[model samples]
Target: MRLVTYRATVEAEARLGVLVDGTVVDVARIGARAGVPLPSRMLDFIRLGPVAVTELGHLIEEAKGRWPVDGALPLPSVILLAPIPRPEKNVFGIGLNYIDHVAESSRALDTSPELPKQPVIFSKPPTTVIAPGDPIVHRADITQQLDWEVELGAIIGTRAQRVSREEALAYVFGYTTLIDMSARDCRRAGQWIYSKGQDSYCPMGPCIVTADEIPDPQTLDLWLTVNGVEKQRNNTSHMLFKVDELIADISQGITLDPGDIIATGTPEGVGAGRDPQEFLSPGDVIEAEVVGIGKLRHPIVAG
Candidate 1:
């Protein structure tokens, strides 16, 4: 199921819906008219447990029984927000999780590219999140070296702590595309938070696909383009740390809840890893695409 959080009115609360046949049908709204009980918010709906998911599945199936868009709103007629526009906590991030990226960056900086013995971790504040069509702010005052890293974002459904790698995938709610917009120079100064956590730095969503739809999370294809030219392209199969390992390691003592987005790092082909760095500037458009998930686009603009 391609689930989303959207709002048609400026004063409306975010509502959960299923995007099907080019229309995002209000699950609860339609279900209510059909006399089915469905939660209106994605987080709240997820909190209802598996029964809720089953109900959501049933709702979509029922809606499709006749026609998916029969009573649904045309997707283009509404504003699509990030699946979770505002996360419950900071967005968890893994740095240097791809071997190819590590190699390229190390060589670019003239350092040995040794594989990390542990997952390199970081977090992005909630403010950094922007929806698919939103603008990615490029603040000129402190940065001229903004870059892009297309990553696979894993959304947690089951709360977990001390989860085993074998069972880590069971805790995932779904997947989405994550573009870790970064400040190359500030990050080079060793301040990851400032470099990666600025307002509208993280662009996520299109929709949160239910976990069942993605059989193997690490087997998806990841690619991103700047102004119609592909800049980064790779398969998730090359990730040094698989999704299960990442979750197990991070959840050793930390509890992951529904709507928690964990960016599983990115692959090689970033702007900073070139002889002459290529940073994003005003009017530049970037698109992050993940197979099985969808595309997330952001237009770079001056702040």
Candidate 2:
């Protein structure tokens, strides 16, 4: 079942709901009708594990029979937030996972840097997150070169430590699309923290598809377009290190908890790699899509 966090009106508080067809069925109201106490927040439900998801699935099935026919809850989509708006931890981003991205970045560097034997990881502050349709602040004064990276984001469901690649996927909750907005100038200084940690730099979600729905995470087609022009086009199959390996590698030292997001890097064709570097302008719209997950679109605005 597709779950969401939404609000009917701007003044109304956000509530967790289950997506049915094209409508959102509020879980609390449905749970009341089904005589079950549903958790108030998405994180709470996520912490409850598969049992909660299963129970919510059953509630949705029951609500379908009475929805619209009888007096059931029907919400408007104007104020819907992504499933998880503010994750507890900053997003874990892998750099140079795609060969073309590595090649392009290497060519631009003053000196060719050796590819890391392990995953090159960086953190994007949680404050950088913005939901689908939200405006992406361009921060023109701070960054002249604003680029977009289309990445497949994996959400961690269970607590994990030192997991094997074979069992890594079991710890995942689902998948979503992530637009890794980067400030090219800041990135060139040294570390990726400042370049990637700007507010609204990480725009993710439409919905998180449960891991079970996606049989093979490595074989999906992912791409991004800037104002209807395709800039990045590649498949997850090209990933140097697959999702399972990434999870296992990340969890080697740190303990990954529920709701932690790991963005499985982007392919090639970023604006920074262009001939004259075609960076994003204030009016540009970026659309990032993964085959089965969903699409994330946001307009660029001056910061």
RMSD of each predicted structure: 1.9, 2.0
Once fitted onto the true fold, the runs of candidate 2 whose alpha carbons sit more than 4 angstroms away are 68-76, 109-115
- Candidate 2 lDDT over 21-116, as tens digits, reads 777777777787778888757777788777777787777776675763322345444465767889899899999888888888877643245655
* Per-residue C-alpha lDDT of model 1 across residues 1-303, encoded as one tens digit per residue: 898988877677778888888888887777786787787788887776667777777767766745434346788887889998889899999989899889987877543599998888889999999988999998899898899999999988889889999999999888988999888777655658988899999999989988889969978999999999999999999999999999999899688887788999999999989767788999999988998888988899889
Compare the candidates by TM-score and give the number of the best one: 1
lDDT of each: 0.86, 0.83
Query: Candidate 2, TM-score vs. the true structure?
Result: 0.94
Q: Alpha carbon lDDT of residue 266, candidate 2?
A: 90
Residue ranges of candidate 1 with Cα displaced over 4 Å: 65-71, 109-112
- The TM-scores of all predictions, comma-separated, are 0.94, 0.94
* lDDT for 136 (candidate 1): 93
